[model samples]
Target chain A: MADHAAHALEPNPTARAFCLTSAFWFAVATTAGLWAAGYLIAPDFMANIAYLQFGRLRPIHVNLVLFGFVTPGLLAAAFYYVPRLTRTELFSQRLGVLTAWLWNLTVTVGIVSLSLGFSQGREYAELVWPVDMLVVLVFALVGVNLIMTVHRRREPVLYVSIWYVFAAVVLTALTYALGNVIWRPDTGALLGIPDAILLWFYGHNIFGLLLTPLSLGVAYYVIPIVTRNPLYSHTLSLLGFWSLLVVYTHIGTHHLLQVPVPTWLKVVAIVDSIAMVIPVMAFLINIWYTARGKLGEIHADIAGKFIFTGTIWYFFVSIQGSVMALPQVQRITHFNNWTVGHAHIGVLGFAGMIALGGMYFILPKLSGKPLYSRFLADLQYWLVLIGITGFLVILTTVGLIQGNAWFNGETVYRVLPEIHLYYVLRLSAGLAILSGAYIGLYNMVRTLFFNPGVQA
Target chain B: MIQRMTPTAVILGAVAILSAVVFVVIIWPNTTVDMTPSEIFRERTAEEAAGRKLYIANGCVYCHSQSIRAFDWGHGATRIAQAGDYVQDEPILLGSARTGVDLSQEGGEHPDDWHMAHFINPRWTRPNSIMPPFEHLGMENLRLLTRYIQSLGMQAADKRMQRQAFWKQASTKAYEAGIEANVRWLSETVPQGWRDIPTPYAASDYSLARGRMIYQGFCIGCHGPVGDGMGDAQPHIYPPPLNFTILKGRGISGGLIYYQVMNGITGTAMPYFKKELESQKIWDVGNFIAAYFIDELDANGPPRGIDAAYEP
Candidate 1:
């Protein structure tokens, strides 16, 4: 425990900048989430308003949450941890700061363009071609920095986190280009059934490759240190890492189970989606074991607490994701609020929470001062936790109602009344998350700039 | 000093326990849902069987679910799917998404010609369907695909197909009787009360905006950028697309338009948007058509003094 505490006290300006930038985007993403939630509840609330309509705002919210909030927060941690794990200073602090600025600029462009209805109309890959290219470029730059750091490492043993961070960045760069079909500037799609298959393969991978691995990497790093214990088994962590790469890479086809792709492809997807249990459980075991009987320690550190809770959500989401992949279950879950709920859970509840934890854990270490407001940080945590949980319950119930009604041969109008309240509840929860984002932004800014003459 | 499970061991054990619980609680039952597709689909003629193969091959089942449950009636559901419906179906084709509407009871919904046009390019018939064109399938295979899609609901589909066959015979006769008779026949399908009522809402800018919004969200997907009813989803709809201009100077009533939009023209890809859009949106869209394409305004008389916010 003392050694872990000692390790956390070192100051690094690169880490400070990363944390500050992450906080800014987190605030933006949650605000978009709240706006979209409000639109869902009262379609008329901002109807006819150009920037706030559900058609435009939903994509903005989704993209912002993915790129603006969660991605940046995770990368901020990676920027700090990757170098430390390798026992090497970052290859270029100036380049790292430049990447953060460019990344924020790209996300800002995406949010504005999407709000103005300039989307390409694909879920998750909604960014226009220019922004998509920018994202790829950003990934390439991050890759160069991280890989170079690895090359210059003082330590010989490359940890599992290093593997995941590199895989996520490189795979995302390749898949984003392919899935966006960036070459076809006109429709951004293939001609027929091939298009649908290609699109969802990219769509599902956004969750599988980008968010999933990044969140797991952060979890692996945070849990052991907080518990003041050695990793139970490096072997298990490595096994889990490789299995995730194999299983998650191919399971994107699960999204096409209902489409007219090859039956053989569907078979592979279903099998692998089920087999996701192997990697998912392996990682969970490794992390939870690292924190065994250390609940007290985790609770005392706000970052550990958030990261631990995120693991619990990963359990719910991956399990639910596996079931939803089944054709039978998908019969009721697809094209309704059910999948939407899963999207929020996986994106906001799982990845979003972990990113915040990473930011919190690194903040004081980089700044050489305690957090500006522990009370406010804790408040933000509770608010987001409640908000996301509420969203899950409300959206799931609405999805089930819509699914069952559609299956029963009832008219769509007859089911609207039943699900109306759930939408309203989701909107209320979004408000909580939105406020939390603002609170986090304020606390982070204060910690970065306001020089209080006290050190804990 | 306290001794507890090492971090690594604890994480591994937690993983094992959770995995076992997931396998037991979720996966086991999913695998056991009596999903032997072959067992359910045993009794079919060679043609229906052929049609089934096409359904599977084209991925028609991907966008359409053959199963109708008790709670589905709110979406203008016709019949609840039964286990008996699947008695002769092998590898039951209960699809996962509703990109296109459900087809459990699609057997006799439309005439063969409508299906032909729809299979060729759904937008020709339904202006808002996202269903892709099957023109590459050529005329014969298109007909075969139509047969399969029409037969999705089994016995119920058979009943509906019978009605379509009956109507086709009469409608063809009426058409052969020339323009006057055909127009009369179309108008006669409407009840007397609907024939007389003009639109309740007057033509206004707000109405046009509301109409435009609904058009973009629902109609524009199928109907083209203009009101020619040539939307992108048209390629998969049948009976060819409705040329809204065809309704021009035809004395189409607001009530008639409302009814068709609300209930959808049965056996066509023009889905009832009653669930997705509210009553006001339908009325506004109808008015947009009347004013812009048809150059007719039935709401020319004194304005109804109803509350301004009334949706229907």
Candidate 2:
């Protein structure tokens, strides 16, 4: 097990800090999401609060979930797994700890700035220049810490998990700088149609390049360990990793297919979008097969349960994503809540479940103790599951109603009353998610700091 | 043979692929998209630019898209969005959602007063709107915002603004020229073919109930519950919503009301409902206004068309 006395005593302060960061922000992000949902059904609930407007609140919810909650949660697991898998301590725990604090500071600054109306006004790229710089800086720092750790490894051949972590950190550092247009500090954007082309390219990659790779890294490491099985195939892992990088990078223009972007760009986006099934199925087949006939083991562990469920959602979201990029399908789904539903399935249901799973998987190991409470974790799992399911069903229904009505020539205003009932239903779903986030925060906080569980 | 991967190889390979993708996807397009201004494009004034900042600041782009597609049937649907039209927009607010309608052609759709009422509280002008109130932006900011909004379609918006300006002057002059002159002007504007055409449907109890529902949803915000033009938005609207009772002795015809409702009084807060409501709904609401507000009825009057099988 490579359980040297020196390794046994190492505290992994960075992973602990990130665990707290992820749990704390998950609560805040969901609360913001619930507030945004409230504004949809009752626009007057917090009327005229400039910062609390639906526009501002929606972006805040999105950015926090992407950066503050899911990314850190996934990274928490990465920080722990990288060192252990390499048969060495982290290159510098002090720098890793500093990165965690700086990450928190950056997210805090983002919230305050967005509330004060200092946005750069681009979706997913709304953090103005300075905040954008901070985001880039953190990605670079994470890349350095991980890469240097790999350099000092006692192990010779890199595991698939290590490959994914390296790609996620290094590639994201490059994409973050390019997508945010860091060179154009004043506007942090390009001019006109090109700007839109660039914004969405960057936006889609925040999920594709950053969250997806990091989440997969954790899955690759956690699944085999928990299920006590070797990976089903090395070839499948190689194919999946390479295909994901090749296909996912250029599909951003699918967002602008209905807009005035070049027809050729749309074609590239559509074809590659459909081709995404290659990487998606490859990864799924590898993971699902490795855990084959091991349902009881997965059920016995909360982390395994969450990650295995996440794979199912990954299958759904990827297939849905491919189909949605088709022009005929997008004719009905584009620019509506259908896209919102799709985003939730990908981010919250797939990546978010994995992030939480990864954090839970590593928490006890990092602390040298058993989990604080399995019951609380299970309760949170159901709440989030129920909430996301409600979101998927209700939001997809609303989008269909809106799309058909608009196609039939009904004004956007006329369709509002028709969807009011659905919005109310969606709000109820959001409440479940909000409750789940708080419950997760409480469980994680107790396990990290105050748990009385016996040391394993 | 087992392919071995080192940390440097993984990181370098991924970055190299990303750089190649960037060149093809982003950089190639950067040099190619025709940036020449479109027929309707124009530069924004400083005030309008400031208002665009406010729009971005408030995240209006989240709900209201600036890009209009070819198949769109709502406002700004007259012209499809063009690449050149966005030449001057930095960060390009081609918003992703349509919780509200597109604003690509919103300029001069209504006069300044309508926006005043709308910005203060959207529900004041649009009874069923889910759009959040921007009253927090205050009066002056709203004015600057109105300028930006009124410039949405650029040259196309300028043309609409000219039409609105001409009508505003004429409508105001007629309104001040006393009651008789105003009613004459209102009816005279309708073509001879439409002025005397009686509403095809009879004013049945069933029809009136439907009419009442439509009025509450579409008109009660601006026309008030009692049809006195004293609705919540009245203070913000100039020349005010018409007092329906004044039309009682003026021989107000169903055709005049229907035509006005279908096409709308462009210079006023009344938007054309043809895109939103069908012919039956427009007739139903018009009949309801005549019976309940003006104390008159023109449905099934002289020269009435043959009764439909569904009529009671």
Candidate 3:
């Protein structure tokens, strides 16, 4: 831990900008989440306020967490580590900073557009065409910078993390274009079932291809460094990486199991969804083995504590995903809060936590200062963990009550009364996450621009 | 495994793998979705199209599911969703959750008047509904929304709407004729055997309480508080709600009330309670109406062998 505290260097402005962008948007994203949760507790609470309605707030929260918070937080760490691993300066810091600014602008416009009800109204692909174009452009800029750095590598062996970072940026650019249907900006869709298939392909990949890879990259890099160990096995790491790319892309249609998509496609999705265990386990075993005897060391470093916890969440979330994807299981899980619970676990508990871990891991190095306050970082971690865990429990329980009741032939309106209490609990849980976001914003701002902690 | 691979191998290989998956999973499925319209599918009217835009804008899809499956018990196992049913939809609104009821076969389930009262405040129609009121969209948008919702079942909805329209004209004539003719029109609709059968349940306090709860949830929007047929839905409905006060001294039987409540009075604002309320509830509510509004209760008259705690 003191190794990072010993560094006295000029600030890496690009990474700092990204870190700030992430920290600022995490606050915004979680506030939108709390607002959405509040609506479930009482629909009429803000019923008259069109701008603050659940419909608008849901897409805003989802987009912000995907773009504004989690992705940027992971990218901040990627920007810092990719260059260091390549044994070179970033190919272009100025371009990297430009991309960060554009990224923020894109997210801001996306949020503002969604709030004003100008969204295309697809799940995850809700950003209207203009914002969609901005997203693709930002990803392209990121691709140029990161791929260029990889091209200029001093080391011949491209580390697994480098492979992941490059894949995430490049694949996302394509996926976003194809998913949002950029050609026909009028509706941002193909026709009917095809559109659902495409939307979910992009949707699941936004997590699988983008967040999963990026978060895995951060874990691969940070775990070894913090634990003071070489990767347990590079062979296993590459296997995990390849398997994830092959298996993760087609599982998006697991979202459409209840709908009338092609049976063959659903088979592919369900089979591949179950097969995701291969890569997930491979990565987990690699990380856990790398930290075999370094448990105390991981605990001592705040970054390791977060990343390690994230890996555990990754294990739980991945297992849950594979289970939920089965057609029989989906009978009880599909089209309800179970999937919502699954999303919270996957995005917030696993990827978002890892993104925060990555940001915290690189913040000291990027700013050439120790974290502004270790205690605040620890507090934010606990708050986020408790909040997300509570959400998973409350939401899953509600989903079960709902799924089983409806399956038993009860009416939709009748079940709402039975599950009303869980909505209240979920809102209370949301308060903790909202507070965590604010704490993260303050901690990140202080670390970047006004650190009172030691520089060396 | 990747130790010997060059950067190009890694990047190109990853993109290639992703493209293959996209083609297999997404692109190919486009050819499989039958674009030809099913018999039930139809192009939306201008008013419905405008209303659909509001539906998307207001995010009504967040809660209501537009499709019903064969395996589904929801929307009362209506026609299982067919792919071609959504052929005319640009971006289909087959929402996931049944946060409200499935609106696939929802068109003529209730009259336009029921929708207005319900949209103004969902609690008016469903006491336990968590749906936020769409009153903010104003009257015009609400009508537009009703058009879109009424069009959900497409050609199927039009058929139902047509039946409603025909009945509306007939019921209006009967209503204008006089109280004597209106009750006769309403009661005569019940089949012979059903009209002879008395309600199995007594009007006990528990039964009336249950009945009142049921009425508040399903009937109050169109039937009004005192059952005078002056509900919030009266203006939008053509023939309007039935005034229970007219049934007094007309020898209105429990069977007449039960049949009307269960099957609904066609062409009027009265919706069927069969799917929403259970058998005991139908009988209890009918008994409650007979006792209070019609100033009569013949449910206790005959065939009292099995008490109606939970009527089959």
**TM-score for chain A in each prediction:** 0.96, 0.98, 0.98
Per-residue lDDT for A1-456 in model 3, tens only?
Answer: 113334466456788888899999999899888888877778877686777787788888999999999999999999988887877778899999999999999999998988888877678888989999999999999999988988898877778888898889999999999989999999888777777788888888999899999999999989998988888988889889999999999799888887878898899999999999999999999999999999999999888998999999999999999999987888888767887888998899999999999999888887788888899999999999999999899999999988887777777776787888998999888899999999989998888779887767
Retained true contacts (fraction), each candidate: 0.11, 0.81, 0.55
TM-scores of the candidates in the order shown: 0.65, 0.98, 0.95
Clashes of 3: 0
Per-residue CA lDDT of model 2 for A127-198, tens digit only, reads 988998899899889888988998998888788888888888888888888888999998888999999999
Candidate 1 residue-pair clash tally: 64
Better of 2 and 3 by lDDT: 2
Candidate 3 residue lDDT tens string, B226-287: 99978766666667678888777787778878888889877776777787677889988987
Candidate 2 lDDT for residue A234: 85
Ranking by DockQ: 2, 3, 1
Q: Give me candidate 2's TM-score against the actual structure.
A: 0.98
Stretch of 10 with least lDDT, candidate 3 chain B: B303-312
Per-candidate interface DockQ score: 0.07, 0.76, 0.60
Q: Candidate 1 on A228-332: residue-level lDDT in tens?
A: 877777778867876786677667667766544456667878988999999999998989888889999999998898899999999999999999989889878
lDDT of each: 0.71, 0.89, 0.85
